[model samples]
Each structure stands twice: as C-alpha cells, then as structure tokens.
Target: MQPYRPSPSPARRTVLRGSLAASAAVSLGARPAPAQARSGRPRAAWGVQTGDVTSSSGLVWVRSDRPARMVVETSATESFRRPRRWEGPLLGPDTDCTGTTALRGLPPGTQIHYRVTLADPDDPRRTGEPVYGTFRTAPARRRDGVRFLWSGDIAGQGWGINPDIGGFRAYEEMRRLDPDFFLCSGDTVYADGPLLPSVTLPDGRVWRNLMTEEKAKVAETLDEYRGVFRYNLLDHNVRAFNAQVPSIVQWDDHEVRNNWYPGQILDDPRYGEKDVDVLAARAGRAFGEYFPVRAPSAGRIHRVVRHGPLLDVFVLDMRTYRNANSPGRQADDTTGILGTEQLAWLKRELARSRAVWKVLAADMPLGLVVPDGAVDFEAVAQGDPGVPLGRELQIAELLRFIKHRRITGTLWLTADVHYTSAQHYLPERAAFQDFAPFWEFVSGPLAAGGFPANALDGTFGPERVFVRAPQRANVSPMESPQYFGEVDIDGDSGELTVRLRAEGGTVLFSQVLRPGRVGQ
Candidate 1:
C-alpha cells in the first residue's frame, strides 16, 4: 500500500515561513515569550506528559518555548537522587519546538517518576526548570488492577483559556482522580472553533476567554493548526494535569472541522478555504507533532493497545478511513466507515487477542443520528430506519463477524455527543440480530459546549439506559455540566466498573459487569 501523503498547499508554505520567522525571532531574543512563559523562569511552556504506555515501554512528550535540546531523567524515586538519563528528540522549528522520546525497559506495574529538562541546543550547559511527571507502566501480571479516565472535546465553542481561576478546572479534578492514564477519545483541539475574547451569557453576565492570534480564526495554515494545539497548553490546569497524568489521544471532526470527511467541500463561512482534504492534512500533521502517539504504519491511526491479560484497547481512526457523508446505494457500496482494510485489521486483532476484556475506544457512536445540513452526515447511523445503508453496512458486518467468532467481554466507549449516557444494545430487539448484545458508554466535552441528547437509530437496537444532557444548546462551562468517564477493571474477578462523572468529580452513573456476563 502506498503511504498517505499530504498534498502541498500555498497556505502551508506561508505557514512554514511564518513559523521559521517566529523561531528566528525567538532565538535572537527579539520577541517576548508566550503568555504562559514567565519572564525569569525556564522555557518549559507546555509542561511534560507521558503516553502510549505498555508493559515495558512508554513515550514522553515535551514542548519548549524556544529551540532547545530535550532531555529526560527517570527514576523510581521522585527525589531524583538516583536517575537514568535518556536523550530525546530535538525541539526545533520543524515541529514547532516540540518533540517526544520513547522510554524502553521500564518495570511493569511500577511507578516511574521522571523529569524533563530543556537546554540550549548549541550549549548544553544552560538548562531550564525541570518539569516532573510520573506514570505506572501497564502491568505484566494478569492479577494487577487497571484504572483509567476517558474524555474528549477540549476548548471548543469559543471557550478558550481563562486566566482568572486556571483554565479548564475539570482537568484539575481529573488529575486528582490519580488514574494510570487518560483515554482522550477525540476532539483534542477544535481547529474549526474560533475563540473570541468575551461573550455575554443569556443571563446578561459576561464570560471571558483568553485569546491568541491563531485561535481567533479558523485554522487554514499549518501554524494556525499548530496554534490550536498550542492554545490548550496555555492553561495552567491543563499543563499541571498533563505533567501528572499520561494520555492516549484520538482525533474527531473538530480537530479538523465540524463533522468533516474525506473529499468533502466545506460550505461554512468561517473557513476561507472550501477544500476539506487540505485542512485535514494540516490538522493531521499538527495532531501528530503535538501528541505522544506513535506514527501509524499504514497511514492510519487504527491500532491495538494490549494491557497485559487485563484489557486490549482497540483505538479506531474512524475519520481517516471513512467515506464522504452522502446518501447513496450502488452495486458496490463497500466505501463505508472503517473501509475494507481497517475492518479486516479489527477482526483479526479481536480474534487474536487473549485479554480478559476488549475495549473499543471509538471516536463516534454506533447508533447516534448525527445529521449534516438537511441530508446526510458522519457516523454509523445513516438515518435509515429499515435495512443498513452507507456506513451502517460496514458496522453490521463487523458485528456479525464478532458474533460468529464469539468474541466475549467486548464493550464500546465513545465521547463526541458532548453529553453523558449509557446505552445498551440487544440483538433480539434490533433490525440486525446476528451480533451479540453489548453495552456502549458515552461521556465527554471536558471543557466545551453542553448540547442536548441525540436520537438513536433502530438498526442496532440501542436503548438509552441513562442520559444527562443540558437543557440549552452551546452552554458555557461556567454554568454548564462537563463530563468524563472512568473504568476500573478488577484483577482477580475480571469485573469492569464504568463511571460517568461530572465537572467536580461527581459520579452521575455507575455500572459493574463481569467479563462473561456483558452480553447477557
């Protein structure tokens, strides 16, 4: 297969020149540091994070305020009395002064305390303030318990960094939970959502958002897309949270634009460019550079994460391999969601996995009706109440394969709806009955607009067991309810407990299911 390459655009060239000029200015001390960077302090602007963890290895990510050589020191002790140093990738203008390093030969189930150091690329003698972080590697033993948090949609709907009382307080609350890692389902950044300085609420009160030049408009240039990622790092709460907790991130529509797909021409007035593919290419590159995810082998982000004998997380890249959102039926309708290659990979991975529980960390829901304009939109449900059509055909086939293979203990977790809900799918009550019954938990919008509930399609028999949505649309985080989900898997009994939490760490719903009893 040919590698997926981004097409060249004139806007991308302009972005490159701008970034290079900015880097040169920073190096010469002609420009001041970013708002988050203190005058006297060292240049660790975004703090540090660890991610993509396994039993014996992990990845650490850092971004500097200027060009620097990145270095990491890890130890079992937090005091750093005895540490092992690992040289990291250079933080340069190419990747917007950001880089990542893979740490290998880590001890499983052991807490690893680490600190990041940035020094002058030319002179290693001058170093900056060290940012500390800790991560417990995935357990190699089967009896070790597992706990992680999952959420999505950050800094959306004109909600940007608020310097008043630390931006995005939900992250601080999530950090306090002390989970091993965070599964960021999607919408890590909203390149399409422009940030304004302030807006008046319905009650006549003014809400303020900390704004930057790049975030004030739609991200058409590469620097603008990179700025979308950089904008979130300006928040102190986000930085502190990242320094303490690792994350497994995926991208959704907002990461490029609202409900974008391949080869679709956007008609939104906010965007100057109508080509969705060009925007997606820039967004994809920025997302890869900013996050700690490994490079995809097949030019797609669909991969499996095995956490010993406890769980296997199948992170699906629904957006990359999806067909355009349109209504059609032809002799060959194979151009659906997941495509052909990804669906085959998913089935093979599911069949070969030996973990007690399989978690499908999907970016979009299976039965939710997400309509675009007046006609069609993205997601598995094509609004067809009868037989499967469009993406639903691919989903139906996958479900049938799972049932045929008797893949047990599989649960789906997703976030894109900007609400919290627990859904149950029964094969007997559905349009399709070849698949086994399963549960899907939805939670998200860590700090974004709160939306109302969405209707479900009957193609897969999704019943809302519990749902919590805002009464109004586009509600602010100050008065609106934000949500996240947590999963805890018992070591001995292999029971998985799922919890949907609100802004201040309140559990809205809770359910516990054993491995063998999920479908039943």
Candidate 2:
C-alpha cells in the first residue's frame, strides 16, 4: 500500500465527501474478489481492530474464521441506527486473507461503534455473524487532555523449555487504564509461537531459520514473522484490547524478522534472502493488513499526528534507515537512527509543533549505554540481540536539536530490550557525560525473559545525573516482564507523570517529568 497523503486537487475534497455519503449507517465501496473464494478457517485469526483514525476517517481491520469477503461499518454511537459510515467488501488473498477497510466522515474527538462481518461476494445471504467493536477519532486541534499507552517486546508462545512471554496478561491489565491509543515499541510478536522454527533445507538437512528476510520473503513462505503475529493477535486480551480502543502502531524487528537492520534480514545462513525491496515490500504488506496502521510510506515507518493541545506524537522508523549496527571495534558515527531525510523532517516537525507535549515514539532506546564508559562494538557489529547501538549519537543530535530550538515539554518513550527503566540527559552539567539531561523511559515485553536482575546497574550512561549523587541515574527497578508504560498529563499544571504498571494493575514505578528539566 502506498503511504497516505491528502489529495491536492480542488475536486479532491468533493470526491472524499461524495465517497463518504454512500449510506446512512454503512456504505460499501467498489472491491474486486480474489481469484478463488476462501473456504476454511484462517490459520490464526481473530480480533476486530480500528487503526489510524483521523478526524474524518479511520481504518477497520479483521480476519474471518473462514476465507470470505468482509464488510466493515461504523456509526456515530453504539446504537448505529442513524450515523455516517463507510464499508467495503474485501478479497482474502493479497492482505493475508485479512480485510482492512477505511471508514470516512467520522467526527473528531468522538467514539463510534463498529462491526465486521464475513460476507459472501456472490450471495450476501450466506455470511458469518458480525463482530462488534469501538473506535475514537483524533481530537480536534483545539482539544486537550489526551492519553495513550506505550510498551514493547511482549513474550511469545513457548518452545521446548522456553515458555511464552507475550503482552496477553499485561494487556488485560492495561484495559483498566482506558488509554485512547497505544504504541508498540517492537517485538510485538514471537515468530516462534509453537517455538522458534528449525528449518530442514531443500535437502532434508536441518537448519535454524529465524525467519529473517532470507527464509520467508520468497513468493510463498510463512516463517516466524507471520506465525508470531498470528499467535500474538489471537490472544483474547490483545483482541479485546484492540476492539475497545483504536491503536497507532509501528514495528520493530520481530514484526518482520528478528534483529533486522536497514538492508539485512536476520534469516538463517543456508537460505538466500530475497531482494531487500521485495522482502521489505512483503513485510510491509503483511503488517498493514494485520495492524490498524495508516498505509506505510516507502517501506518506512515514520509519521506524525497531532492530538489537539494534548500532544504531538512522532512515530519513527528506526530500523529502515540505520547503519549496519557497528562493525567490529569501530563506531559508525556516520550511521544514523533516522535516515537523513527523516531527520530533516523530524527537525522541521519539532520546530513547528504547537502542542503542550511532544513525544518521540521511538522503537528503541534513545539515551542509555554501558555504565563503564565502554562500547561493545563487537556485539553491535554482530547485531547483538538486545543492545541499542547508534542510540548515543542519535540522542546527542536530538538533545542538541532540542537545545538549539529551545523546544519545551519534550519526552522520549521507547521499547525494545524488554525491560523497564527511566533516565534523563542534561548536557549543561559540570560532569562531562552529564552535560545533557533528557529523560527517557523504556518499557517492554508483557512477559519477561532471562533478563538478569538489575541488568542496567552499572550500565547507566553519563547523560543522567541521579537525583541522589554518586548513584547513577540510569538504574531501573526490578519489575515483571508483564508491564506497560503510561503518560498521564495534568494540562493545567503542565506536569506529565509517567507510570510503569505490571499485570493486574500493579504500579511498579512512577515518575513526574516537568518542563525546563532538560538543557538546564
């Protein structure tokens, strides 16, 4: 799917308005059927979700128990008796047999009830039962008091002795928070649902395929990426969560192939990866179909949305433009987390924003490093499993930019590296490393894995100045893998309180971030 951009023609608005006027409560658009009618249950599919809802439109997504055309409708309220809506019949092949229809003419800052049904393209009488859900449009430019959830790295199904660790339990707990939206930092799915796949080559010989690009990008292949998303979305808690609220999503490596960088897919060595563009194209297609994301732009995951006076969120594409992790014992200063184009766009957005809080919704950590002032270029070069390389330099530039523009009310929220912690960077400090104090809160993995106790103890970076001297500011509390992070803002006071919660609504950690705390 092509990236979403408003049409510029004078008749563009007329076309949109006309398309939105097809029906009172529900309307169907022109859609051609797939080559064959689908019959049989989707390998792993369930859940009715809404994504990328602007003041006037939103995307409705679902997969049927059986391959059939699907219809989605939206209404102004729960009792859809009289409401504006949009609907479309979908063919179940190109988009993983899943359907994503766009709903238009929705009012801003309002909640609407929606339903999805498996329909028969030729005979409308034979259709599956409709599934009901809810969604909210983005608030108007003058609105305020918005809230959302941010977390990452959910545990997936078990393999051998390795148990499943997913956000199923965490999501259940987050339901109580009633966030308007949620952001996944990455690793949202475990490709190894039944367990990591052990591939037997074309020659009956066995090989391990992480399902990275090489193994699955061929015209026909379903590896970890597909399997993981299948299983993750199947979780009742996840489906229920999505059905209840709209989500704005972007992916990390797990969504495609694990530990993938800009041009490389971390697949097994035996299989040759498909061309980068082809593989990336497939991954993008699958992700757009499964998640409620706005269509992607050039296989890149970066976009910005303003939620009235409450906030301005910039979702980044860290994996698409990164330099190859760091090669051996060297730092690739030229490598950037945000490609030059994205970086330029980010600067302009940052300078032009008018919201009270501007959040950089990063998929990886932006400001944390090894405590001993050491850089593990080897692990980085090899594309270490959990380390965030190039983040330091990214933060350096980000902090400098913030300082230069004198932007206020800024914060960084990220996932990946499946743990919870918060650190601040201040570049004006007396200590060389503490010269920058910008706060970052890292949250992830609804299910914790073998992450060691206090793993970040001595790993605090110099950017942080502990509220308590001598004690580094980078240390995080020991918490369950089943945790979610939240940002609750008190608009009148201009105070933002971040809370880290465990399953069952347990508040494990909390911090209050204020204005003028950075670059002081």
Estimate TM-scores for all models.
0.90, 0.74
Each model's C-alpha lDDT? 0.80, 0.56
lDDT of 2 by residue, 160-261 (tens): 111133325566566545676787776665432334355333356443323323223322243333434555553455666676667778777655555556
* Runs of candidate 1 exceeding 4 Å displacement: 1-42, 296-299, 328-332
lDDT of 1 by residue, 115-211 (tens): 7888877668888767677778999887888889899989998887766646799887876677878999999999988887898888997778887
- In candidate 2, stretches whose alpha carbon ends up further than 4 angstroms from where it belongs are 1-45, 65-69, 141-144, 156-167, 192-224, 265-281, 327-332, 370-391, 429-436, 448-450, 453-481, 515-520
Candidate 1: the clashing residue pairs are: none
